[model samples]
Target: MVDYGQAVDRQADEINPATVDQRARRLLRADEPAAANAPDTHLLQALSLVLTEGASDLHISGGAPPSIRVDGALRPIAGWDRWSPEKVADALGSILTPAQRVEFDKELELDFAYTINGTRFRVNFYQQRNTVGGAFRLIPNEIKSLPELGIPASVARFAHLPRGLVLVTGPTGSGKSTTLAALVDLVNRTRADHIVTVEDPIEFIHDAKKSMISQREVGQDTHSFASALKHVLRQDPDVILIGELRDLETISVALTAAETGHLVFSTLHTQDTAQTIDRIIDVFPPHQQAQVRAQLAATLRGVLCQTLVRKIGGGRVVATEILVTTAAIANLVREGKTHQIASALQSGRTQGMHTMDQHLAELVDAGLITRQAAEEKAMDVEVLKQLVRRIDPTDTSVGDLSNGEIDFNDSFSPGRR
Candidate 1:
């Protein structure tokens, strides 16, 4: 068998570093291995290095030193020599197919997943400051369930619905995709249906259990998410997952798909349930906002806002706020009452709805999280602290009101934060 590593080195050496960016190519050639002797880490080794280092991401720039992201922060590992520009080109040629390379070359940016053994990686390649650098996020072998993640039960319950849209929202590295996987897995085990997912680069690989799954990558199986959704309706799919509602076109297509009877799942980099909805509506122009909101109000099943908080044990856990679109909630959305949804979540506890602040206060009272940390991450710090009821050293029984009084806070706390 032709060794993949040797072949890569030969190919990289063929590419003229002078033609490409110089600094990166120079770094690549520094550790140039002979065609006869190449050092290639097995995909398994790559996965191991990431987990052992507690890295959120691994960077294998074409000609730069490999780096890792720890606790949502990027830090280059010490002592690892930088790869020369030619070496990176060689590695790139080794791992990526021609079509993938062409796509990368055109846009100089890509997001996809890589696999070795049982682990999966979320990969993103892009041109940065003139040099080529990429990030690979390791997807752990164990797919933590919603309960295990301490995400609200209401989110997992979304799996029970036949058709609607469920969104997982938060900043980057906040575990939105992980939560999405947990929900989809729940459906995979319980329901017998076809679930189709379109991602930039596929992440989790779910087996065909009770549900049949078809995963399509952006540049591999199809051109883009919009194209995938465009034809998904005819596939007789019961569940469709759009990796993200990133642009206006994709958002429009997703909403339309959801409206037609498919249970759509997606993610967004937003802070709360209301903001998540607003994000969708605002992505469109003024002329399209009303139509998008109306469609969202009708097809939207739920919204889960999540965050990864550092636990007392020195690891991360997701805390989430779940907003199920009840009749009142839907009415509020249809009527443009986004601000009132938080109040509805608080009062609709029996229906499995919950505001983030309520969950944060509960976490604090249960000793799962510190009160001070909760206040810092809380969207409305003043409101959440009031809900947490930090005894104002002044009064003992009922407690003295802080600035806003001991009434309630209005934000969602996805985790300990």
Candidate 2:
């Protein structure tokens, strides 16, 4: 049989000449049998590659070579053996605890946190085509501030609210967690309060500053988010960070927490501000919708929806739709006229509230991101085109960005084009 390692080495030599010495050194590290049986070796090497390449996510599947997402695209790691099902299982099994292993075996899917060489990773293990596979995203230890992330400065206000529900909504991988963490960290630094975070698998580790912090992982530290929320009020928490408001029970409790005078932060999988409001209200049964709306309108502090777009040169830029609840917005919510929320957002820019399209237009005019990329990420392409045209009415080239071929479902991180 041909040696998979040697074949990878040959491929690497063909593709990247500069890495020949590095490839030779890696090949000399271990014998074939030891390397093949110990999947940990392969996993560790792949993770190390993630660090060196400054990649955001690592992908491992049975039929293909392990790949890493560099910038916003997938680049396969060369000089690595193709993963086999048995090999993948062995590697994953070596890392998962007995309970996690049992859970994976029973459910065929799992999400957990793993640390290697001081770097933390958020891992999702799953079954694909009847075989085990996993995806890993590296979580940076330090949480970036809002300005550092290039988000609007108005977001800091949500952090300072004494009591209310702040929802950071976005598609997966849109930096929602990062933004939420930044907000929580802001509050942590600025206030002397007790903060409790209940996460599925705690991503960023927050050290106690002036504020006391207690982080609980869903499955491991507590039974679930609902369970933790049920008892959190008794813990004397001045601030609560819920990783995600994924269900009605969790959302209900979050609203209760907000109503009871503790600052609460959470996230939802939604695209824009109005849709985020509609989603939370629609989560309840028909009979509860009105009451839910009332509760939300009263307790909702703000909704910040974010999506990452390709910047002009390289890296990603965040286009955010901000909804800072005022009496006008609250009345709109209470009156059940959420359809008009978009109009409110457009006019409320002076109040630090703006739609995603408006933010995209600003980014385009500032030359921070390409008009094409902004159009592709906009909630309303035609609206965005009009916004751009207004900025440069004489420039007829604005319409070129409306190709209608862009897939909005894809999530991206800060990376090269």
Candidate 3:
């Protein structure tokens, strides 16, 4: 049997380039009798590649060479052959515990955390086309601060609030979990209170600093999110972090938790602030919608909607739409006038509230990302163009507002393009 411990301990930089392909071919040989019983050497090498290349995720599936998502794009590793169905299953299955194997066989899917050489990953194994596939998301060992993550300074205020609901909403793989971890870290460093988090397979492990932290994994610590949340209030928590407000029951309980004077942090799969608010309200039955809206207006502190955009040189950066609830915005929520929320965000920049397009323009102006990339991610292209023009009145490449003509070929020169 291969010594998995020694293999995992080897530094990624130590891998000899000349023998990498030979090692990969030998490890992937179909005749290996113990392939199903031990974690494949090739799988460990691919994970090491993820670390060395600064990739966010590793994808293993049948009929494809292992691929890593760097920045925001997927690039298949060179010098590796396409994996067969058996090869994919053997590599991924070797990592699952016997109990997890039973569960996966019963449910056809599984989600859990795995740690190797002190680096943790959030892993999901699923069946597709009668074959197994896996996705491994690398969780950084060190949690970053909000400023370090390029988040706006005003977002730190959410951590200071004694009570209310703050949400970080975005699509999958949009760094929602990382941002939430930063906020929780901030609270842990600055406050003296009890913080309880309910996560499905717990991503970031928190060490209690000034705050006492109790992190519960859904399947391991409790039956489900609803069950954990049902009893969390009785645990005397001052701050609650629901990993993702994924269901109606979870959302309802989170609202109650926030309403009853506990600061709540959660994530939603929504594009922007308006949609996030609407998603919560719409989750309830018609009879409960009005009450939920009122409850949301009263307890909602802020919503931060963010997306990852490819940066100018390499890597990726975040573009965000932040909504800091005010009397006017609260009234709009209560009155069901969410469509008008965008205007409020546009006018509320002094309060640190800005629409997504506005921030996209700022990122383009700062030369952190290109104008074309910003336009692609913008909610309204015309609005983005107008904001870019407003930032630099002398730039004609953004197109004359009088006639809608844009020059996409104009290389983004930061100061005056």
Candidate 4:
């Protein structure tokens, strides 16, 4: 049996002063009270550490030093004492409003955004093991373009469509929100239309540029997604951005909006293109599914499914699968033959459609990420291997797709090709 506690200790030791950036080291060396006694101060310091270390999230819990997630791995911040449950609650609660506190007390969980020192974070406070814990996800100050984010340039075409539903799907923390923001920014810059976005806690802040933007948050600006979307059309919106298609009512209203000739953009916590189609249809009742499918086929423009994989040296890169709803794909959705969608993606490359494995294979061939990392994110490992082999027949790293094993020793390295 393995001793996981010791393993964690070893990992923690790896994050020493020498390994951290200069800013992080300076913050660590600052004179501050113990975390147990000064929870609020420690919380701010931890948030600052997140920025300095180039981490995506900061995690706070009892019996653990505040940790930040970098490149999909968690590392404890050096020089911080382990927090107690009361301290954890106090630190996180200090930032909440009185009304928010009441809501949190009642629901035992809360989701909100916080900004400190000009940096914004999407925060969540929840109960775990009968104690309060918090997660702070750093929101980038600037919204990156699709190409900068490694999204295919073809996806930008959806931004120009006069009407139809464009869904961005991925698991949690897969940069779905970021992609949606980029598309919205694209519209804001190039088009002279009214863009209305309904978000829960509103992650990105978009100012009016060439277009008019009306952003509504769930709790503050509106009651719920269904409620805000209920009257959005009356507001004269040419482009609608729904943060996530969370329920049947929201999904129904969004579909209606798209069908009514409004360009709609939203997100779903589904893994891939096929699964995204299935999830939308599955949300309605059995009797309503067929009609929903028909509506989806008529209004759905495209789906971009994305996931982040660890880069070769450090940081992360996005691997995406886009489905550009060709007539055949629309027919598949209408007929409920969602399984055939993947096949459609395989042949629809000319139409800007590609599978997740294909993009992962491309990333490996470009030496942006290792073969192992691509394999981990691949929907079908065998298919990914075959795609990689096809991309570079001389790539001795990828063994025969028929075999179960790969030659990792010969796999991709930076500039190896």
Candidate 5:
């Protein structure tokens, strides 16, 4: 087999020759301005610096000069001329090998991870109307803490349990993987058991501490998720982490992994708690719906419906609707009464459970986040208004709080979004 590390190093070497200063717009003084403008490997070197400086994402396109997103804002990198379509194509073509480009062409796009300056980037390179363009999201070297992320104490409770399934739900770029990494890190530090993670081009890197970790990346360490799931059972794993439950086969395998003495962690693209469950069950054929519901009812440990709400501190806070499957919740799920799970969560807070609205109300009360953000992300508005009501009964009137706005209420609605 060829060495990818060496191939990546070649790119690194190519980048170093240009000495693109990521912190500044200036290219190395030694390189000719005309050649640098033409497109070269040094762009990756410059990207390496931008990433090291904590830029959230980077974009290269046909009409625009290369741009980088730092702290959620777009800032133009100085010293670069307006890049034409040819320049954009040259920059992308220089890095993508002939084979990679062929594959990318066939797919109309490609998703892969590339490393430079020891920083890993989740890259999506593709064509746009016959023009080349790409975007890269920086993945940090260290896993951030849940508490550091201002994740509720209850969300952390998902990691403390030893078995069953925990699902993290959020929209794209909503910190789903980072949240999962925090939870996984929690287990890695506190538990003494075998943990296995199956991912496509694995994101977070975990160092073995109290727990042993086996990370399998698709197309590299394993051929597919189904095949890995087929063999992980004999590996004596105490926990199994699936990157995303994309297909029915993997979903079935994950539930089986949980049912047979293992704690399972996975993420899904869903807005709220109820929708998340619906999407999961919908993945299966109608013929097997009843059985899958029964299986989920018996083995679901929790479902953390979360979103990265803009916080008053200028970053973000995680307001999560956590569903810890209690006897009532399990019964509701088993009997095809998933809607009742929200009420169960609201009343079960003493047991470390909370609906999203409840959590949102708590954040607003604590002055951590605004109330407006809650209503906009809310799946059920009447319920959020009700929760605010309980916070202030005399102030029965409510206003929109979806855009970082807050207002108190007295009538607490049983809304689980």
Candidate 6:
């Protein structure tokens, strides 16, 4: 019933970056209901646009038409109607359960998953200056394989490991869930193991193949992540996929699971391997820090930090920093010298360990992403510049290493663990 194309064309004119930000701020301040109530099919219409446009995310906020993010850029639908607080609430009632409304009212923020016409979405509902807003991420019906996602074969090696902790971390929207699901799917196809997963709200639904999967939603199937993790060992699970290691208690339990010979997969909001290690250790009390570090050192199997960037032509490319733990790296963790982990990664190339900069540079070399874009997301600007120069001989923006532009001894020191 909606003329989707006409609506998009009409609304596209009003979607300049400045106007988007201005309207967002204005809506945040006013936070009042308007004259019209949104029609019952408002939410469905927006979702329909997402599928038709192949967008990854949809953002609904007051004082603006529903906007979709495609290939990392937000674009407002052309003919969509702007939303008001009361209208937003009315539209939300169609998808939210009565109990969910109560929870949303109590906490002011809620997360859950919903299905629309066979496509699933990971939904987040929250308040913005007293107005209801929602962020919806489209979850594809079919889980993509590692090769399909452009992940290196080296990453698949971790999926085959029988024990220890393997982390896939990055900022939100970095495709962590996708990668985790792919790994779990790999195990499900090749091994006759029991896989148990604990998620806040299970995103991907896995079918039994070579393995049997038991997915426990944090609030629904279990009281909380900590509670489920506490009893998971008794579940006789061979491979455990924890949605996140959010707190000290959960982290401790995950570490324990890995130490006891369970191959545990988890995610963290970290940018690199060193930072991931630091975050876990910093979560514990000072007195327990040393012991936690040693435990992590002994159990950490690998870390893959990923980021999604706009590709040269279209879609998006994944850049990853992989850390496959070795004896030397384990000793470094035990010795409380995490800052030196970057150098270890540089020299551990044979072992598949590399920094974020290395991954970004590789993308630049392969022409999947532009050097400027890669450099912008790069961790070490100097190193990225050198890499880009090496790949592109004509690039003279940064002097060569022979011209005193870089000091390898200072940057890549082989300090003892």
Which one is best on TM-score? 3
**What are the TM-scores, per candidate, against the unseen true structure?**
0.79, 0.86, 0.87, 0.86, 0.79, 0.85
Worst 10 residues of 6 by lDDT: 407-416
Write model 5 residue lDDT over 1-417, tens digit each, in one string.
111111121222234433444422332222311232323544665575453333557788888767766434566555455678897778766656555667777888876666543556677888888888888776666666776555656678888887899999888766778779889999999999899999876877899999999999875688778899889899899989999999999899989988987999999998777777878888999999889989998888888777756555444555677777778878787778877767777788687777778767666665555678777777677887777643552333322222232110000000111
Q: Model 1, poorest ten-residue lDDT window?
A: 402-411
- Would you list the clashing residue pairs of candidate 6? 7-78, 7-79, 8-78, 8-79, 11-78
Clashing residue pair totals per candidate (backbone < 3 A): 18, 2, 0, 0, 20, 5
**Comparing 1 and 2 by lDDT, which wins?**
2
Question: Cα miss at 294, model 2 (Å)?
Answer: 0.4
On a 0 to 100 scale, what is the lDDT of residue 10 in model 1?
Answer: 22
Global local distance difference test of model 1: 0.67
Candidate numbers sorted by lDDT from highest down:
3, 4, 2, 6, 5, 1
RMSD for each of the candidates: 10.2, 7.1, 7.9, 7.7, 9.4, 10.0
After superposition, the stretches of candidate 3 with alpha carbons farther than 4 Å from their true spots are 1-36, 390-417
lDDT of each: 0.67, 0.78, 0.80, 0.78, 0.69, 0.76
Off by over 4 Å in 4: 1-39, 390-417
User: Compared with the true structure, what per-residue lDDT tens digits does model 2 show for residues 1-417?
Assistant: 111111121222244434533543453343212222333656766765665565678998887888887556687886676888888878766667777878888999898887754567899999999999989987876677777666677889998999999999998788888888889899989999999999989988899887999999988899878889899999999999999998999999999999999999999999998888889998899999999999999999999999888765555677889999999999999889999999999898788888899878877766666788988898889998888633553333322112111222112444333
lDDT of 2 at 16: 49
Which of the predicted structures, 2 or 5, would earn the higher TM-score when compared with the native?
2
Predicted model with the maximum lDDT: 3
The whole-model C-alpha lDDT of candidate 5 against the native structure comes to 0.69
lDDT of 4 by residue, 73-160 (tens): 7778776789999888888876777777788899998888876645678989999999999999887767767765657877999999
How big is the positional error of residue 351 in model 1, measured in Å on the Cα after superposition?
A: 1.6
With a 3 Å backbone cut-off (N, CA, C), the pairs that clash in candidate 3 are none
Residue 119 lDDT in model 6?
A: 61
